[model samples]
Target chain A: MRVLIQLRPAPDVVAAVIEPGVRATAADVAGRLPGVVLDQAFAPVAVPRPVPASAYGDPLSLNQRVEFSYAPQDAAVLVRGEIADDELSTRSVLLPSARRDVAGVFADPVIHSTPTCGGDGPVGHWQDVARLLGAPEMTVEGHDGSGVTLAIVDSGINAAHVQAHLGREVIIDTERSWSPPGVGGTPGEYPVAHGTMCAFDALIAAPRATLLDIPVLLSPHNVAGLLSDAVAAYAHLRTVLEAMPAGSRSLVISNSWGLFSPGQDFPPGHPGNYSDNLAHPFNLIVASLDQAGADIVFSAGNCGRECPDRRCGFPDRPITGANSHPRVLSVGGVDTGLERVGYSSQGPGRLSDRKPDICAYTHFAGSEANGPGTPDTGTSAACPVAAGAVAAIRTRHPATEISPAQLRTLLHRTAEDRSTLGFDHDYGYGVINPPAVLESLGRHTRHAA
Target chain B: MVLLTVRLPPGATLADALARLELAEEDVDTAFGLVPIDPGTGLYAVRVAEEASHRAANTAGGPFSDPPIAPHGSQDPHDRHAPPSG
Candidate 1:
């Protein structure tokens, strides 16, 4: 958390800060705050102390007319710094008492122009996303998702619709694909809907990657599926992952779905609860998959405070269950213009805080699965798009060579940080930068060689 | 039906699980079968009636909630609330 520290440093230091052309630094006014990393670049500024103009006026209340005094003894010096996000509450309370000179500590929030929201139009086309991701460059360097198997575990995918929109041959590994009980349609033949959009978006970067169509969401009564169905779907995927030789195994699962309402779930502290309980069967399975060398990517959900999906149920910290799993990459949405969409769920997640681990492109003109010209919008689109990038990298760096955990670290390290302070809830480790990831990989490969 | 996990050796079938838990054939969702949650841990899961889950509580892990999940995106961007299935 970025902060401004008001310190009643020595009178001379305050006068030095107030003096013209003196150029006093943050270190000069507030030196070595225990928990705060002082911004060396920020020059210390003298803040005038407000005194009641009339003797009758209350000294504490600012409701009456006040006089601004820059007297060296009365004035305070303001210095800039950041406290660790996790320790913000503890440190903010302790700072004033820890130093007698510390007059107050205040928040320094990131100010931004209006954020893009669900109702906003598409920012750019899918081709623009390709360009930003450096798809052509990735292909030239042999990172085109040649052998990786990317799974879309959502509504059944319509292969024809995805192929038509992608203008390329789509590979549906039918032999590996599986459907939930009573879901009638064959893999890749369900309908033109969310799953098809996810497929098209994933193919943007990993065109050659084999896709395993696991339509876990196609329940007989409705398009939505129970979380137990997903447990079964993942169980099937575990087998597919184990079937591959350990030395070359690479399976990426994309989940653009999540539990919308807590009313459907057991309450938070209950033993049967799914949202906050790590011991829940589904959460355990997610861990099992991660341990077995699968890169799982989940949408952070459409519960952003700015403009949430109507179905959003949790009052706060909506990223829940496996969507907030530490093992998986919880993807949030940003437009092609790299502005975060208002519907992307912010974190301090239910399961693991500091979630929505990264942002990826969405609200783009592609996969007209929604309609004639509707943008593939939401963290739903972002999840698979990021999954596709993972597949592209997995083409060369298999699980055996670079484990999924290591790859996650690499992606987090190489991302274009959106916040002045790293890893904020809104954008996580900033937007996913494929070019930077590829470069980092190139450097590591050469180093290893 | 709720989900429950039981410790079973690798390659154990649904019948084996039913027998081990002393559950009648009709007590579980046969179509859902016995799915492995973690083969390494010998942990397998099955969907069973809430009463069946309680009956097997001494041996099984949970009568875990199986909440409904929907896709994150709406069908139409213009109508942000449009259901994904619409």
Candidate 2:
């Protein structure tokens, strides 16, 4: 019964609503109403405290933070009132509002992590991904992503392990990179292998690009912690990118994670719903990043098949949330046989008609420093592979003002069509054709000159 | 609510153990279905409706269903884009 009470207070009423006084008034009002028990009130702050690096240390972690509220509105107060469905409808009439200054009420929905590993037994090689995308030829032509940066936003990256696997110096900009502020471990230093595996996979395509490891998922103890922290991390990322030098090469953000099973009772407007609605904090942050010219990529998820592979049975609705955002490139997984993997999530994404903008190889092997084997596979593997390819092209055309939209167009136009026709749900436009994409970019460069 | 820890033999998948738990579609109620203790170690924390409690205990390892322990602690707490295995 968590509710967000949005306050619309005039200048004179603003103080009453913004201060703890409004909460007291609401509590008093709730006391009179039958079956209503006022639980807690959250005052609005102009600027939220930055999320701490460690999950347990942050006081605000457990409570809801007002990400965005309308102007002329004060703070949103959270309350728990036990009332029956029929009586709940009377809340608008019974709850204190005009004098107390509350505008709207909405539920605060909980979000969960979209739940990876591979090594040794059946190793997936980087060469397979490169060959699948025809990247070796491009790599030979010197488009190995020297100047660009690929930011891996995931649990945390094992920078040391990635460097060991590549057998060379790989730059991981810790200062420029972000994690929640107070977290003790450095990027890739923590035990999580997902980030490290992603970093290794991205390097396979763009070996020279610098890695920016932003570890947003800190609740190593709970899955809900992983899902909830993402929104805040994106907000922090927006701030960091906004402060960076404007003329520097735009970054490629690789996110190989998303919400898979949004339970039955989830609301349409809830952030966990992954709706295309622009108001969602996650979508807003993604839109901001796209406007800043960052190429954002996301994995489509792994719920394609029935019981054996996916825990959620069969996905009724495949893609949602940031993965469904039109601005970002949503990727699906294909195996070495150039066929869609049984577990690769399929879609007509929540927001867009055509989803999984493209496919890349899965079960692709890469080095792992923390675990026993090369545990990088799935669309998680595909996303970084696609990101690395994009970085290489950005490196080749460093001065070109290739916006996110333009890059998406280029990928769509140049992709090798594999499925039904022009664009299919499983393969999107087709398999990512790196050499062809670079060739298209080359033509654009020549034409512009 | 029945909490049981089922240990899987070598080469056994998490899905295999979950099937052994006999969780039906109607029986599935939580936000997440399975919480892995250590997939490699084949250990899991299975929470099922009380009716299925006896069946969970009947598995080979015998149900350590007294009070369920939390899943294994890993350096990584987040989900990835792919399935846990290749």
Candidate 3:
């Protein structure tokens, strides 16, 4: 068990005096005690003074704990750990309590409480229902959500969405969390007006799969999240998921927003610019998600000259070159006819290589005639549709049959070419055809784990 | 510990910047390497020296600080406790 030891600060602790409290505690913690380790108070995980390690438990475990420094700059080091000493180890250290603001403030199950999928609002992709159910493949076996979880990394999804809460059957564990610099409320929510509409697209695709909606956007007054903050939010989502049973197994992630701000390179010391591998924290977060074998889908940016790359749109450029390395399913946009959307982001990323590997639907350049402005007009909207499509495909096949990366490769290999005979710059591996994809899947006997 | 909270800009990444801070400090080289931070939602869990957070109080509410903990509007001109007003 970890205890937060608040020691009276011995002045001269600030200007590196005596190396600060948490440092003091870390220095004071000798291996002789067999419990505490000296730690720098201000690290990514936040360890307050003498950071203690509890190896004996789980999130609910009576032992282990992951601590963060409450105030690195302050003299006090706030350390959180399991209760180790016998005396304080009552049945359960924290007795259940009926706190004041249970409903409006603190609610039950952080991720499950919000509205999403089948909750109350409109499902933008309901039109694809016919495409989903009739896909001969999904119904091959029964719905199996046992070990697979879909991590919808976007704005917070509404927990009340009917499909997410009710629907076809039972998916034992599903969740959601709002990590922010959230602009409005604490949990950055997926409103009818949120984050390029990727939030709802996932539910429309896989209503019954266990889900983890990690809301990265936090601004209350706007429709989207901040670039820098979005990166951090994605990172936080990874940490939160790392601790859960729902976190393990094959995961599918969907990200629609893209950076359109040219010359967005922050000064050498800017927050957006990180190491060689990570262009931003968001990039690192995406890489981390990929390392976890979570099948991820990113909108190939709706910056193609077909439509204006105006507003926050980046010319639908494939995530390649500098944006390469962290391999993921880069999805380009397609029209209803399985042809590439003129507005689909063109590729070979900034480094000009390894362009978009997959393709999905964007409304007639996004809006038909005028196209469906909100849900279909952008590649952001198209990314989620592809995500949902993958979910349906996964449910039909089983995780052992198809890993996220494999799924990505298969989709690309079988894509209908919108370009000449083979791979093109705009549409990627062409558009995704459900029946064609299903047929292709039947040909392969090799299972993916 | 001073908690500051603020929304991040659309294309900016909170973790990337945080990484810069880590670069100069060997103790926290990759502080946010495996662990990433999202700038959009709530108080993201992070660690800073108590004095660091206190000094952060000088720039407090800008991002890591939020309500139920710090006042939404902190009076200090160098208020790290208050986030950039919406």
The candidates' interface RMSDs, in order, read 2.5, 14.3, 15.4
What fraction of correct interface contacts does each candidate retain?
A: 0.63, 0.09, 0.04
Report the candidate with higher DockQ, 2 versus 3. 2
CA deviation > 4 Å runs, candidate 3: A1-137, A143-147, A159-176, A181-190, A220-223, A240-248, A267-280, A312-326, A364-375, A396-403, A434-449, B1-86
For each candidate in the order shown, give its overall lDDT on alpha carbons. Answer: 0.89, 0.61, 0.44
Ranking by TM-score: 1, 2, 3
Candidate DockQ scores, in order:
0.48, 0.04, 0.03
Model 2 lDDT tens row, A10-71: 44344444455454355432324444544545334221223434544554463533233323
Write the residue-wise lDDT of candidate 3 on A223-304 in tens digits. Answer: 3444444545556555554654542445666766554443333322433232222434345446555655566776666455
Tens-digit lDDT track of model 1 for A78-148: 88999999999989889889999998989987777776677766779999999888888898888888999
Q: Output the TM-score of candidate 1.
A: 0.81
Model 3 DockQ vs. reference: 0.03
lDDT of 2: 0.61
Cα RMSD over interface residues, candidate 2? 14.3
Candidate 1 vs candidate 2: the DockQ winner is 1
Clashes of each: 0, 15, 106
